[model samples]
Target: MNLLEKGDDKDIEALSGLGIVSDDKSTITKSTIVEVELDLELEETLKKFGLRLESDGCLNWQMDASAHPRNWSVSRRAFNTSVLLALDLYTTAISTSGPSMAQAAMKEMDLGHIKSLIAFSSMYQFGQALGGVVFPPYSECFGRKAVYIATTLIYCLACVLTAEVPTMTGVCVGRFICGIMSAVPSVVVEGSIEDLFNMKSRVWIIFLWACATTAGLVLGPIYGAYISAYCGWKWVLFTGAIVTGVFTLLLLFIRESRPSRLLAQQAARLQHEKGLSYPIHSADATPNLATFSRIALIRPLRLFFTEPIVFVCSLMMAVSWALIYLFAESLPSVYASLGFTGPSTSLAFIPLLLGIPLSILFRIHDQRVLGRRECANLALNPEQKLTGFVIAAPALAVGLWIFAWTVPPAVPHLHWAVSMIGLVLVGFATNEFACTLSGYLADSYTIYASSAFAALAFLRAILAGVFPLFAPRMYSAMGQNLASTVLAAVATCFCGAALLFMKYGKTVRQKSKFAGHSLVVNRATQVKGDNVE
Candidate 1:
């Protein structure tokens, strides 16, 4: 019989002994192979019976069988792969950090050129916003790997240009290009991890990503400091360019993980093997370029209008981000006025170190204790995840207030570090919680995850870009204490929103087209290889 022939239960059961699982679509199109040191005559007999010989000498036979391909399981190996990709995907945050430090370089080149810094910061923000708009569509159309490669390549070139350029305009242009291209890493992180991880494992991985992001924040400034102090400001761009080039070469290992795209590949391979005209195009096989373009362009706009959950959450996340950038800009000047040395200026960001470890611990605690509590029937709802933010918002406000009040020609350098500790503590909380919420949104909104994020990314890039322009003036006008107090108040308002989410998030999610549908609550109900619209 042809290997594709249907078999009965006994035949399937017997084949199961050989390590195959059966499902509704079971069929095999090739001969089964079995090999062993049977007599030559027996081997010949088995061959005549349509069994193929094996290289290892074990008896191998082909039975007509087709089992469901394992493209959707959230196993240990899959989770590990997802985490690694997520880590790689978020390295774009480094690009964002790079420009903030680039400002410090501008100061070294000329202290009075505040207008130049403002122009650079504004361009960076617009580039970031443009990237946010474009990357979502690209990720949806071409899949994550393509966008990753394309953007990283552009970013690398931009870095090289920035490093080599002699004029302020050249550096500004390079910074803008880098900002736009670097967006892929941030946008791709959630989608890539979700492609492999389910809810329980996703939480831990999200935590890992959050901590990793903070590390970028910590390292980027210090990197800029040393480069500007010792090698001149141009090296800041050169060094980042070199690092991105190395990473770009490392992209060889990443594979296409999008379900729809992979399915299309599989379907193409199957058509070639079937030796037939072609299978009717399924949803997975539809190559409507116009449709993809429309979805890519319009979906995020729709999500922004339709989803209040997305709006509030994104705003909160953006506010936190703006504060981080604002503070980052404030630091060199803040510490300089406090009698700190140029080499030691970057070290002022050392307060961020405490936040990184705390995020990891929080992630571990949630996975071990909280996830288990639900798994063991300790909680009725998964909304307990929102609690992490409740802790973060206040810390943000408190830290900003502390850092603001303590900085100056008056306050000691140690006091700045102390306040920074509080600032980073809040950062750890907001950053971690934001990641968790992102996963939650992905689960809740099946078709619009990328779009929803795109909307939020637009908001985030705008705030992050615009806030720094005001950084000098804000600190200049209100002084450190009051400027920070204003930021702290903004964070405090968002804290109340987080509390609201803790109480009624499910209701909010239920209202979302994207968030409600994307969540995978049970293994049986899991949708595999789904394209987040």
Candidate 2:
């Protein structure tokens, strides 16, 4: 009954000359692999034909590697190019500026109202959260490249529909579709960097990715301003479509990075060398897709209930994200209160622009000093990364408090600049902490990375959606200072909760089924390195 015993796992190419022992259904042990090593001469021949063997005992033959120099060539240019397009699409299509323009257009059509606008925006976030559940799982089930292409196509289609939508409800539908499709780029950014570099060097790539995302936030308003001013709101959607189309075409050359899938392909080639006509796949090896049961659908939800660390960190980051969106959304009203029209509203993003460079500097410091120290702790213990957030917690609190007190009539443009600088600092630190947390989770629990990330994304989106709907009302009711003070208190509570875990987080991780075993293994590796080779 052993699957391997029946040669179901044998590479089809490897069985080309080897006769089939048994093809009967019951005689075979379902989808199992057969192990067979090729002779040195056969291996050499396979290499000549551009093939590689995997541990699953199969052959994966493909075209020559050099035949696709462009595929393997990973320059900063190519990475940045893809990154820029993805970010532009995300920022231009999803940011407050984009929606505000669409709202204006809808109002001109007599269909705009606060409830509908809020619902539409909330749905966008909800769609994103829902997509986090679906797309990441599907990407892990399939491969990153395929998912990227599919999402890009979907996004393009949605944008076309959005631009031409006749009613507010249709607009909401289009935006929700666009939001769902938008989930892939963030996932792809992490995957792409992992494909290209090792951990030590990945910090820079992360920095670049973060900056690109921030730049989109700044530039979205600027471009949205111009588009909304000159051509109308439809051009906002139109511009996104044109840019996304070009990027989708560029995606024709992207390579896959899913390790299990790549390993399967290699196994197929190894089987080819053994003359097997059909190579067996080892899907059971991957934790993410090993079980195709209903339980798998709710794994992330299970994680939410069980993993306190994931819950706290994701909640903190989600609150911060919502606040960022709230600030961005209200900027127009703030400017209008001060008598600025459409063009000048775009100029307001200059503060955000100035803040980004400053944030990058802080992020660089956090990575070089704090991140290294924490990651090294991971080799010894899992809780070390949580310490890095200690610095971030206060930075966020102070920045928010200062920004709250300094807004409007009391201070001036300089105060606004300082507030932005403060916000950028907190944003950068929060981003760094979240990124490192995710990386640590991935390193410690490699198999559960997609689901864990999906869980975080889902929660963050839910919070982000709800927070924005209440933001204007909260500010109106409580005033900016009081609302910010309240948010600061909430953030402080998170910090306090985070600190408690930082003190005991390793013990906590060591108790969880998902993390405990990995912690021991990683610690063993470090101890082994210290004692032996």
Which predicted model would earn the best lDDT? 1
Which runs of model 2 end up more than 4 angstroms from their true locations? Answer: 1-93, 276-295, 359-388, 409-421, 497-502, 516-533
Over 342-434, each residue of candidate 1 has an lDDT whose tens digit, in order, gives: 667667767765675665655665667655665675632446565666777777777766766666634544555566666576667656656
Give Cα distance to truth, residue 382, candidate 1, Å.
5.1
lDDT for each residue of candidate 2 in 309-395, tens digit (9 for 90 to 100): 667656776676566556556666555545568667656666555544544554465456645554566333334444456666776
RMSD of 1: 9.0
